[model samples]
Every structure is written in C-alpha cells, then in structure tokens.
Target: MDNDCMNNIEDRKIIYQLINFAIKHKKIMQNYLDETGVYQAQHRLLMEIFHNQNASQNHIVKSMDVSAATIAVSLKKLEKGGYIKKEMDEVDNRLNKITITEKGKKVVEQSKQIFDSVDGRVFEGFTEEEKLTLFLLLQKLNDNLNSMEDELKSKKERK
Candidate 1:
C-alpha cells in the first residue's frame, strides 16, 4: 500500500478502537447516569457546576465546547428538574450565575462514589504507576490533537 493509503487505514482502525471502547464503557457509565436521571452531556455540565458553583452559563458552554442553544436547553431541563438554579448576577443581570441545588449536590455526592468505583474496577489490573503513565500519555495525545485542530481552523480561515 502507498504511505498515504496505509495512514488512512491506520486512522480508520484508530477511530474504530475509540468507538469500540466507548461502546464497551457506555454500559458502565450509562447505568450511573440513568440512575441519576441525567444524560451524559448534561452530566458534564453538572460536574462543572459541582466544581464551580455560581458559574456563568457562557463560561460553562465555552468550557464544555457546546453550543449555547444546547447548553440553554440542558440548563432549562435541569432547572425544571430542580437540580439547578439560574440567578441573575448582582452587577450584571445580563449574565446568569448557575448554582447547583441541594438536590443536585446530593446527586453528585452519590454518583461520584459510583463513578469512582467503576473507574477503579475498570483498571483493577493496572498498577498505580501504569495508570498515571497511561493518563499522561492520553493527555499528551489529546493536547496534540487539539493543537492540530486549531492549526486546521487557522488554515481554513486563511483560505
């Protein structure tokens, strides 16, 4: 095979591996998310709020890399479910500060235990050092991909 063709084939296999891994872990993650009655994407927002209470909706959407509409819809659903509260900023009413409700806190506290246990069990065979090394490698790969994405975007903008 030509070098380009070989690279294409390898890329496809890498994509397949990523999707397969996600499918395998979906069951483990979905069970916990379902029990909490939140979608996976919404859980990302919840986790963000758990760490950064009274966070601005715009900040959350930017950090989460989701569209404003998507974030708004999710926030509305969560608010209706009594998991979150959106309050107007004291100085700038244009910006909304989102806070996790007591109910949301309880959910996170319980779900965190489930998530931690699942993560531990998933890599039970790996030593602590192995886990750390794998994490660092994955982080490096993720950062490289992000940089490549930015480069592509810049090239497109120039064109």
Candidate 2:
C-alpha cells in the first residue's frame, strides 16, 4: 500500500483507541458516582453551584450551554434531595439564587477525592515521564483540533 494509505490506517487506530479510552473512563466514573448516590448530571450541577455560589438558574443554563428546562429539572431534583437550596433573590425577586447546601458541599469534596483516586489509578502503570509526554501530546492534539475547527468556521463564513 502507499504511504498515505498506511498513515490513514494508523490514524484510524489512534482514533479508535481514544474512543475506547473515553468509554472505559466514563464507565469507571459512572460506577463511582453510583456508589455516591448522585447521578452524573446532578453531580455536575452541584459542582457548578458549589463553585459559583448564589448563581441564578439562568446563569447555570448559559454557563453549561444546556436548556433551562434541563437545568430546572436537575435543580429540582437536587433541591429535593437536600443537596441544594433555591432562595428568592433579594434584589431580583423574579430570579432565584441557587446555592449548594452543606450536604452538597460534602458531596463535592467526596467527589473530588473519588476523582483524584480514579485519576491516580488511570496512570498507575505510567511513569512520570510518560504521563508528562502524554499530557503534552494531548495538548498539541487539542490545539490542532481547535485550529481545524476555526478554519472550518472561517470557510463556512466566507461561503
């Protein structure tokens, strides 16, 4: 086969490996989250509220790039579970300010520990040098992908 064809095959293998890695990682995370009694979406929303205390629902919807309805549903679940509390905004009565409750803060801290442990396990067999090399390579790949996206957008705009 030609050199270009060989390169294409190698590229496909790399993409496949990346997809598998992502799937496996997700499964592991899901298993851990299950043990914590928090759904992945709720955990994500809780983390956002933890970091951005007193944020509005609309702000979370915008920041997360999700629909308001989706955020509202998660918020309702979280509030019912005592993970978060929604209070009427003092100045803006129309908007409710969302804040993480004490329970939610504990969950967030536990989630951090869980994530750290999982991350450590992920690189269990890798040396420090290998980890650093992988980080650099991934960074470069992300930069290249971003550049490609920008170029595509520019082309579309031109047309």
Best candidate according to lDDT: 2
| Runs in model 2 lying further than 4 Å from the true structure | 1-9, 155-159
- Models 1 onward score TM values of 0.80, 0.88
Off by over 4 Å in 1: 1-15
Residue-wise C-alpha lDDT for candidate 2, range 99-145, written one tens digit per residue: 99889989999999999999999999999999999999989989999
**Tens digit of lDDT per residue, candidate 1, span 1-159?**
689977667667866877898798987788777888787777778889999998999999888899999999999989998999999999998999999999888878878988888888889999989999989987987999999999999999999
**Model 1, CA-based lDDT:** 0.88
**3 in model 1: Cα distance from truth in Å?**
25
Candidate 1 Cα RMSD (Å): 4.9
Q: What is the lDDT of residue 129 in candidate 2?
A: 98
| Superposed Cα deviation of residue 128, candidate 1 (Å) | 2.3
